[model samples]
Target: METDVLVVGAGPTGLALGIDLARRGVAALVVERAEALFPGSRGKGLQPRTMEVFDDLGVLDAIRTAGGLYPVGMLWQDGRRTGEYRMFDAVEPSEDAPYTEPWMVPQWRTQQILRARLEELGGKVAFGREVVGLDQDEGGVRARFASGEVVTARYAVAADGGRSTVRRLLGIGMTGEAVDPYPTLVADVRISGLDRDNWHIFPPGGAGDDYLAICPLPGTEDFQLVARFPEATAPDLSLEGVRKVVAARSHLAPESVTELRWASDFRPRAALADRFRSGRVFLAGDAAHVHSPAGGQGLNTSVQDAYNLGWKLGAVLRDGADAALLGSYDEERRPVAADMLGLSTRVHRGETRRGEATRQLGLGYRDSPLTRETRTHPGPLRAGDRAPDARVAGIRLFDAFRGPHWTLLALGDVEAPEPDGRTRLVRGPAPGTYGPGLYLVRPDGYVGWAGDTPAGLPDYLARFGRR
Candidate 1:
């Protein structure tokens, strides 16, 4: 088989990338070793910035429909409710930032939505294709599957989780530390006595005992159960084992856990790939960095990785941009991944709270080579900052930024370059988030260049093949 890009592992990262490439008319295929989609409620929180990415990917409405906001956390003592508190710091939605809180959706459901969108855009995924060997040359990549079939593509991405086969085949090394000495068991199960309105938490009964948490998954009847065990001890994944742990940790009976749908155990660890790129292959998601799940940054960061790489791949493969433009993917995302890794580790260790930082709206590529800040005195939103959403000239800014295209916001008499095949212009009065200036918004929704006029905009656009 031959394709423009070969995406390894049909997890959220691979599927999201496939969707982005497909919408841009790039030929790509997502291949997964598993026979079907992942079935679990893990990685359930969608941070606010990720919601914005979903909006642009044309899956926000379906995501919102399939999921709901997180419930207030309810503490329990001796089977009686003690208190309730919000999980994240409360932030109200404003005109500039519409999504303030994280949304909750099972990881499985999220992948399903992304895959559907990919297919809607004429993309395809091949299941049970295990890439056993990968060979890359100056021109392209050649991959051999375990099934004795071979496929070739210009590029390949490793979204195959932490122990990525692709990353191993490329001999890339990972650096990290175990965040916690103990192991955590997370599962999706049906419970008999827990109310779905609150996330039930049971503190450890004794010094040696472990804590248990059962949070209801939105849009489903199952609750996600989490428990910790002593180091070097394997937490049982069997139904009886889950029941025993729940009964011992909480005040519930063994039978309260009616059914266990899926379960896995892992030691909380933090790791980052030494390099996100090797030859024609690039690593993304868990393959690039693995985070402790405390801040809910792992999956959100992974999806955004796809968002960042998608446009660069499209520009080079479809829009005739220079291949050197692809180098920015590693230069831009690796640092962000490292920062998120630290944030997740801090949140996991209880050294930090899930406040503004956990929302990830503050992440950007301010120091990236692609960002050009030309204004003498730029406003709060500068080059490489996320262009906030606002109502400008009777049209919503996000509405203007949607789709696979660059957006030029010519606010308050800043003349916009004539609209071209790949760029859209939004002319309006200056909104407070962005003081009057010419903002060149990248397809991924960051301010690529800002100037008082369109003085250097043409050169910057030309670098991205915006003719």
Candidate 2:
């Protein structure tokens, strides 16, 4: 095999997985159809959970430097305000919860950062090499590229976009209904005389009945304007069309807009693949699920998908762990995708706007066996929960709320157990401050089990560790 893992698509999901695999000394090769990284800002926001994953990759600082932080609040159809809700305000980080704020960065910039990190880890994305065809077998998979190149790998991850070539080759059906009233324009422009502090200027009935979402882009005078139009009323991508929409919706003159960087029409749709993995070939990101970009969860979920699968793939390839470990990827992530699909549908239907809990606190996995066995009540965040970030011992880091690895947090006078070379124990000030219990964090940064006894630690490790 040319590589241990072959990833199709150089977007966030594929790049993230490639970086993690490379960090773990796995031979990962990534391919992208585009000749150059996408320059346009597609998905321009990162959720709090995604930021935590970035922190774990040691690229959070770089992402922070490249991005801007904005406190998000909701604006109702009636024009009532729901005061700004900071991403970290609800869930305080402890030794358990780590990330605090959801950083808003353009998708293009985020991809650049991930690509740079992947290079630092000694892997590079093969751009313009699209996957034309792929065939999988019991031991390995063979992939053919558009550039007349072919390679084989022990496994392949299809991080490709919604219309995945790999998914088609695998004969996997995407089961879902299309959202009608198609064709909405998402344009990013530099407009004057608009309040930059707030988002969403709804016209009576919210997004469904002519509402506009104004997203402030840091370091630039531009803002992303996501406007949904009735299918029959949708206009062409022209200056006159833009002017017409803005005038009809906001009573603002089109001439006030100086520069229009990108303006394109897109339809809102939701879908989920019938399967996530087919033998050794797996589908992730948009390949597994897709939804409207209303809540900005597309890129975030894609990156998280990579984070969940990367370490598992690395461990399995390097440590010779059971193949069952890979099954957990589909088990854990599919539900999150389903939930996001539902959330995006609601957002598209204008049922609600993005809330604080939706942004930070509400996402978790209580169904996982790992969380069910060890947790009495959901820890700061539960399994399948979006991990929270908090300050601990004056050190700021992404907290481990998802279950995978054992996080030995030494609080107070309690000395940390001697290094077992496997567990990651974070020593903090004040003993017994972690609520009289020790935490065992999973690889995805959730608490798998917690207790004061040494027996709990061994059992937790034995359950998740390579047998």
Tens-digit lDDT string for candidate 2 (1-467): 39999999998899989888887789999989889886657788788778777877868888888778664644643335634533234445455444445567777778889999999989998888888888878889999987778999999999988999999999999988676465777777878766776554545353544666667776556777777776677646776777666655664577866678778777778899988999999899999998788666788888888987887787688766667778878887888888888887787677876655446445665686556334355334333443334445775435432223435654445434554555666666633323434555566666555554455556545544444
Model 1, backbone clash pairs (residues 3+ apart or across chains), number: 0
The C-alpha TM-scores of every prediction are: 0.99, 0.83
Report the poorest 10 consecutive residues by lDDT, candidate 1: 412-421
By TM-score, the best candidate is 1
TM-score of candidate 2 versus the correct structure, residues matched by position: 0.83
Rate residue 28 of model 2 by lDDT. 91
Candidate 1 stretches greater than 4 Å from native: none
Per-residue lDDT of model 1, residues 135-239, tens digit only: 999999999999999999999999999999999999999999999989999999999988899999998887678889999998889999999988877999999
TM-score of 1: 0.99
Best-matching candidate per lDDT? 1
Candidate 2: stretches off by over 4 Å: 69-101, 179-182, 192-209, 247-252, 360-362, 369-406, 410-417, 427-434, 456-467
- Candidate 1: C-alpha lDDT: 0.93
Task: Give the worst 10-residue stretch by lDDT in candidate 2.
Answer: 397-406
